[model samples]
Target: MKLLVFAHRLELGGTQINAIDLAAFLRDRRGVDVTVHATEGPALELLRARGLPFIPAPDVRLHPSPARIRALRDTVCRVRPDIIQAWDWWQGLEAYCGVHLPEGVPLVITDMMMHLTRAMPRGVPTTFGFEGLRRQAEAAGWSRTALLPPPVDTEANAPGASDGAALRRRLNVGGDAVLLVSVSRLSEYMKSESIKRTIEVVRELGDTLPLTYLIVGDGAAMPRIRETAGRANAALGREAISLAGAMTDPRPAYAAADIVLGMGGSSLRGLAFGKPVVVTGEAGFARLFSPETAEGFIETGMFGHGAGGADNAALSGPIRALARSPDLRTALGAFGREFVVANHGIEVVGDTLLRVCRAAVGYRPGRVALTADAARTAYFYLRERRFRVASRDAVERG
Candidate 1:
């Protein structure tokens, strides 16, 4: 099958990573031809590295104009794909409103942020990344949402030794110092304020314990992150924490770490590396994904939200425990890796997406449906953008 993978951006974040990983799977394992298309994002270097055929697009206008629609139509004409997979809401909106989806070609929208997708394009088949999102969509009268669990490249993230020793050396940390690594986009909104708080934890334990914190990836919150790192190091009078910025490959960081801290895809990637992961998210969601929390974590996509929020456990204790006991790290890491291999490897996820595509192809969308969807989405997009921006400003102020 010829497939066009549409991404919100080509940045170094979970959604982009997930899209590329699955696109790689389709091309390598499913005997499919894949082309990637993206709007703006900083991970252009990573995209070039993938060697996948790509088309760069301008950042999608929430309300796509005729020319924008023509661009998508032209790409579709050129690719003639059997399935067009959109990685998020805006991608789906652009495809649905801005261009003609060929009669037989299926447009599959994967909802990476379930709650944030309050205005998902109607009538387009959507794949939810977590069970929680799937349930919410279904309860809200959405019939097409299917759970597409996260997928990681098992081979790349296979159980490994400390090849990260070289990374540790490069970062100028002592060989014996316990390393805590995070490989996620450093943004306040999506990242659950974990990175900021982790800075505080590192400072709190700076003198008491010999440790190094390495943060990878970049975003809006980076200026603040860099400022905090600078302040923390100056206050400690040493390089206690370092920002590695963004890297195309996070495997080395995972390999070198004593423990990995992240939420969602980043946590899963750490688990894939056979590293112990402390899943962190918004609203007090910070806990290690052990055998006890495995089922719940998997079901909710490693994030606890709203009233179903986290246990609010003190994270340093878990990090300290993992740092102290190599045995525990090994045990927990092994368990986490096993969980990922069984449930989230590309083979499993790719097959599920392919099946959804096949099922979706038979349903043909009409002009009436498409027009209605476009109008509704445009209204929702404008209204939501205003509200979301205001809400974000309010949250930031608080």
Candidate 2:
């Protein structure tokens, strides 16, 4: 089946990564004809590295432009894809404007990896972010919306048994040290505050537990974060924090840590590594874990809210407790890994999305609802225009 995927930019975030992975997986495994339309960014290079076909889209910023919309529509007319899949909010708007597929062309929207309570309305098919928005979408007359969570490669992120000793030594973490690692773009608001707060919490815990904090990823907030880290070190009476910038692969850092702190994609990566994770922010937040499993590790704390210092008081106890007990950490990590595998592993997510795409292309609202698998096959058959069945070939294949 021919499919077109759209994203605002191909940046180094969860949504872009998921889009790339999905396109590659579909092309390689399912032999689905796939084309990616990226609006902006270096993510296109990554797609090209994997030998994926991509097209550049007209930029559509805060307000829509008629020319840009027409350009996108013309691109869609040329491609005539069976389905148009959007990777995030902006992509959804783009898809809505671009594709005009008879009555069947299905437009499927994905939530990427964050939750936005204010952005998504009810009944709109969604995965993680805000429940209220889901309701709003439904009220707005979107016929089919489903929640498909972000996919992660569980095997690549599994923690290694020997990583702890080796990583601690590499980072110069003492035997009594509690290492806190955050993997996120420094410029992102929540990530910056989380790093700052973690440092403060380490200080509040006193010098009893030697602490080393690692900040990963780079962004507009780098200079500010560095200053904050420096101030935190001085306040804590030691160089307790380090910034490693961004690494293409974050699995090693996740595997090496005592605890992983951050939100959205980073937290998901941490879960895949079986590391205890702490998440912040409301957008796409609900997708972090199944409702039953999210109680302890997930907490609601405002970033950069307090005055005197970071609000480590709220998270300090949990951090210390997780550090002290290997059993607790192991159990929590296992739960997170299991949850991600069941819900967000690539194969599962790919299959789910494939079904959604098929439904969008084959949609006949009044007709009977076929099983997701059957719908996919039918959609493919229709797209390929295979009206004639070969009895001999079918029998031979069977």
Per-candidate TM equals: 0.88, 0.76
Candidate 2 C-alpha lDDT tens digits along 1-398: 99888665555656677788878888887889998887666567678887988878765444234544566677677787877776654455445444432234466767643334233222224443233334444565444665555567676667672365665677787776667888776654444566666766766664666668888778777898888788877887887888888766666688778778776557777878887776643222212233454643323211112334424554676677777787877788888888678766878878877877776666544434323323543454456443332111010000
Model 1: residues with Cα > 4 Å off, grouped in runs: 40-42, 60-67, 100-105, 305-313, 365-398
The lDDT values for all models are: 0.75, 0.61
lDDT score of residue 116 within candidate 2:
42
Model 1 per-residue lDDT tens digits across residues 334-373: 9999999998888998899988877776767678876776
User: Which candidate ranks first by TM-score, i.e. highest?
Assistant: 1
| Minimal lDDT window, size 10, model 1 | 389-398
